[model samples]
Target: MEIVRPHSHRNLFSSNDAASAPTIPLYRSAPPLEVRLEDFESFAIDRLRVLKGISDGLSRGKKPDEMEKLVSELWKVNMRHQHASEVLNKDIISHFVLRLVYCRTEDLRKWFLSMECALFRYRFRFLTAEAQRAIMDEFDITCKAVNIMEFESIKEKLGQVARSMGQPLPTGDAIFYKVPFEDVPELVAGRRVLLSQGYAYVAMNQVVSLVATLFRSQLSKTLILTNRKWTSSIREQEKHRLTPIVEALCSSYLGPDFSQPKEYAEISLKDIDQLAKTSFPLCMRHQFDKLKEDHHLKHGGRMQLGLFLKGVGLNLDDALAFWRAEFSKKVGLEKFEKEYAYTIRHNYGKEGKRTDYTPYSCYKIISSTPGAGDHHGCPYRHFSEENLRAALSRMGVNSRAMEDVMNKVRNRHYQLACTLTFEALHGVPCDAGINHPNQYFNDSQKILQPKKDSST
Candidate 1:
């Protein structure tokens, strides 16, 4: 494939030869090539990791510079290729793969759209002025530059809007673009641009927001169209091969294998009670408490808590013993061994399918819906506000910290709320935020038992 590389040394704000510059993709059309299934899966996963990083950083309230640094590091590790052409190919192919994967459901579409827009904005910021203009032209984003007379007429209003938005006042020489106010509602809503007669006067620096608006609009429509096409035609034809891959990509957990605890500390049954207090996330801690109190747990709770124990380094023998001991208190050893023993072994890949089930991430836990008697799901997501508050209080979280967590929960940022809870309990900042229950446990252990080399 022929790839046109943008000028490496050109500053984002500086002009370059527009004819030779490669613009960041709008992902309007699919790449015309046959990709190996292995490469196809790899490309989709790499792009998914990037989008996941963007989602994580935004949810944690990372500023633009912090988000930029985070994304840059992720791109270097996951998306960068040895050759420019390979990089371009992966970029295009990965986007299309994810579009197919995420276009399945409304929730998936919204998430994909949001993260892709963020990725676009991040990449667009680093493009040279010429490359950006090339994109604008290619996409037919016709935002007319205001003439000197119109600029002079709106100069005072623009200055006032800029002042209100804490931006520097625009000078007479500064260029402004006139786009329909509907096209850049965010800029108008934030009072970052001057508006007159249904048009927004956007300064050059703010044009990225305008362009982002256009990119988002275009991508949103494309996703819906792609979904309609997939439903009407693609589903039946590709059900066996490509469809399965797309479905797996949507539901797959791309994080570390928590089932294998080779690097983590060895956890014994004797250590579980103390560890629950110090290391468990709120969800695990809740389940632990419930199990001890009732001496029995529903299937949902058992699976959730059982897999978490496995992740924390409970060996198969210890796992069996732990469940047998807990259940024997209510049902005698005969009944316990008959009913519950196999289930525990199954989680260790000892029975049925012989698949080593990994511990649930926050996403998995939050996505699950617990019933009236269930204790499986994420507490931050499943608990009523009153119940959540009570749970926090029981953990000795102060009123102020509880409120902070509640606010994040209220906004539907469950993982962030969990992170806040972690910070409150640990008395240290959780910079990356918590993604999995096991991650929370690992992070807590690191803080409580600092490594000897680090101490030195």
Candidate 2:
């Protein structure tokens, strides 16, 4: 395994040469040279944010144009660069770092591969013809260009396929490639290209799909090999230093901290019931309902719901009063004060470590393991199919909406299912998708309580 040193401090490609260079990377090389601990973590986290943006857009069923717009905005924000070399080096180092982080599990590998493929396709589609050709040549992708004589014979069939895809027929001199159907299954499956015998006639505009297929195949194998190397050959000391970072990245929440309440109306104990009905996410609502019915919640439910309420503007006084009011019903005031008051105060940063813990994001909630009788984790992830269906029905999701949400759930896209549930209940698309419980609550409030214009 050859180690490739990252040229982050110097330019690998001159500015004049950037236009024709293949800026989109294949990541076929080994891991980059040693980076500082801080750089290593920050680079990986930033790249993960980009990948998550892509995943969220796709999961929410954004159309191709919408997804492209979303990804472009994300790239500009998270991956802005002053020079082409800087961009390529950061891209390379970040890809290798995330491979280490995501290679540990099958689910993680699938997610990374999917998002990376999407990223590759986005870059490939936007590149100049020369740049795309350079990448194809670099990868040794052999697709025979259809000659004029051969193209003339198939032009009508190809035009029909293009028209079906809502594209106009290419000019007489337009280029098409003849590749095995297996090389571009997505185009074949979508019927976006003409297929005759075993070969598929892919239009030049649709070549990104073929390149993306290759990237996915290569990256999938790399991730498995990375996992094997990670577990078996890496030095024990290196693993000791890096494993914690990998684990943290896997479960880390990169969103804004929701420890402090946003600028919303202050929530009192009396408003809790109404808010739970109209504004709370399903996880919090489930905990709220359980607490109301049972007069108490175990530790897991308390922490989950407690931090969420704190994030929603329930100050310390109201938090303590709210918990005590219900808990006292079961444990009596003496025991409640002794056992439960401290934890509530601690969550408010008034006792113990006074850490002021942030509310759990969807990532954290979904990653959590809830034991039997606990209603702390994400419902979309933790609920059985029958239970999820019943929960959606209770939320007044229509039959069609239920099917859409259930389909996302069946595909193991729990967050997407949650986003669909939000859309179905609210009657609007969750454009950014639901990343945090607080985000869902805030979005719901924006809809349910539209602010009045003071000037008016």
Candidate 3:
């Protein structure tokens, strides 16, 4: 591989934001690799194996004791891996922070370690290369000529810098609060609380493992690998806060790309009723069929129902207009009055519920579906063409040109689901952290520095 000189923030692993110019300049003289391009089922089959063994052990042995052993074993592996994988796979880390990773080679570890002294000032395109160099020099100088600041002190100093710059704070998986435990409801089950606590611990370990894997994906190899059980205690915090953002952004991007016509395709509900005979996503077709044959609903009935309400009175072109008007009114219509309102119009303007969807209009539908395990409503998985046709038939959905939509569903092209509905939920601001104690980044580093065996 050709060695490209590592430039600060520009070329190195810029965390999850490679989509943009790099901000941190790597200090290395060269890089090792180039990253350019970026499974769900039968997973249960493997878990079933473990479950059977554990069950047998419990039945043939001391039940609680066996359960304890089983739990401990599962805990160990989960703490080491899964939680972090969830975050990394979900792409939350890149959302909040600028990431940087130098192209790696196994042989360079010792050399990189020796030269990492001037690490802090490494600049990227965002900052001058000189700025990065300066930070690195200062870091090096501090390591050598001054006191070595622990990661905690460094984090605080960085936090101060971030505040001074008016940038977002660097976050970890876990969070801490001043709230005392005594304030919790006495009626709450002690075991449930304990379970939640256990899950919290497991979450932090996952975050660390996630960090490790993220390093692998971006930098091509794992860094600061987990031992057995770590990252879990903090991960649940991030998972709760980040999941919504991921859903919104990914869904937005993955959502149906709407076609803006010079004029809207205006059709009465009665017209749509005829078109409902055929459409994509079998579910909608079937539902429309059911409504027509069984309930004998008319275009008026279907149109009044709305797709979400099982109505097909209006075509997608008009439906898009309907949603745009709904949220535009809800958030208030002083477009010229306030700047943020405009931001809302520009972002969540067209997409349903995800107008606040930043970066990408991607969303994950969490609906009631089998095997969805809490997060469901992916049209690719849930939709059937016949049912969709039936539902649309009842709703008077008039669109013979819905073949494009069916193609998306038959191919499991899920993001296309949002496109057909031309209906996006409002980009709801997720303030879940207010009630969720776990969303706060953790302070564990103050007590325990991240290290090789830090997970244990």
- Pick by lDDT: which candidate is best? 1
Candidate 2 Cα misplacement greater than 4 A, ranges: 1-21, 31-34, 82-85, 163-166, 189-192, 195-198, 384-390, 393-400, 451-456
lDDT of 1 by residue, 212-244 (tens): 988898889999999998899887877876788
Clashing pairs in 2: none
Q: Which structure is stronger by TM-score: 1 or 2?
A: 1
Worst 10 residues of 1 by lDDT: 1-10
List TM-score per model, in order. 0.89, 0.89, 0.25
Ranking by TM-score: 1, 2, 3
Candidate 2 local distance difference test against the native: 0.84
**What is every candidate's alpha-carbon RMSD to the true fold?**
5.2, 3.4, 24.8
lDDT by candidate, in order shown: 0.84, 0.84, 0.30
The sequence of per-residue lDDT tens digits that candidate 3 reaches over residues 189-240 is 3321211332211111112222222222333222222101113432344355
Full-model lDDT, candidate 1:
0.84
lDDT of 2 by residue, 399-427 (tens): 99999989998888887888888898999
